[model samples]
Target: MASEDLKTIIENLQKKGKMAFLEKTTPEKIEAFEKENAVTLPEKYKAWLLYSDGGELFLPAGVQFYGIEHKPLLNVNCEDRPSDDYVVIGALASGDPILFKKNSEEVAIYNLEGGKIEEDEKYSDFDAFLIDLPSGILGIGE
Candidate 1:
């Protein structure tokens, strides 16, 4: 999705009472997380984290943004690092992974049910992913 589209999506979620990320995690924590992972977060994602450490957006298909302390990619454990070539970041309500490559910056959906990776170049980054995702799981929509 385009930048403006992303903004509109976020705003829509907010208007619908689905977006609620409050400022929580600290910069030091975020820094440690990055250092531990050995990856630099993109600017938009980094800024969102700084703005709202982490929170949930409810839409029945609720999406949870991993907080500095939550480890959204590492499955709630910073020790469980994902393999190279792909890094796990967030997940669908169904527990499927949302991953991306370092250089590409494109986010892909991984199906836990099929053990398959699906990449259609649909989402380019964190913001885009959030905005482009389906309204939500069953019963979680506008």
Candidate 2:
């Protein structure tokens, strides 16, 4: 899926009045997160933080992306992060982490039992993951 497809999905969701997003976060806060974590966020993900921060995308059972100010990333202030090389962006309903590689666009799901990425599930970037999200979660496109 492409970025245009993701935009269409959001547009449709908005047309249906089903989209929900948290308040946008400031660049300063984003910078703070980067400085504290010693990692720079990918450009697209940074854009997202500025746009919606994070929120439920499709309503009930929707993907709930984390926010900077509220519902912070899973690794925030935690010693037991899923992976030192990854930043947790959110969790699946079952609590498996949705991780984004630090200083890279790579994204994947972190399996709790395995304590590692499910390699086959990896996406090239944040937009790619989101492009697959609706169908991946609820068969929306299918």
RMSD in Å for all candidates: 4.5, 3.7
Question: Which candidate number maximizes TM-score?
Answer: 2
Once model 2 is optimally superposed onto the true structure by TM-score, how far is the C-alpha of residue 120 displaced, in angstroms?
Answer: 2.9
Report every candidate's CA lDDT.
0.60, 0.70
lDDT per residue (tens digit) for residues 1-142 in model 1: 2246546766766766566666656667768887887776665566567666656676556666666665443432322224466666666677776666665666666666666665552477777776555453223366
lDDT of 1: 0.60
lDDT of 2 by residue, 15-119 (tens): 543667878888899899888867788777777777778777666665667877767553554432465777778766666777787778987877787777766
Clashes of each: 3, 0
Per-model TM values vs. the true structure = 0.68, 0.78
Lowest summed lDDT over 10 consecutive residues: which window, candidate 1? 73-82
lDDT of 2 at 45: 76
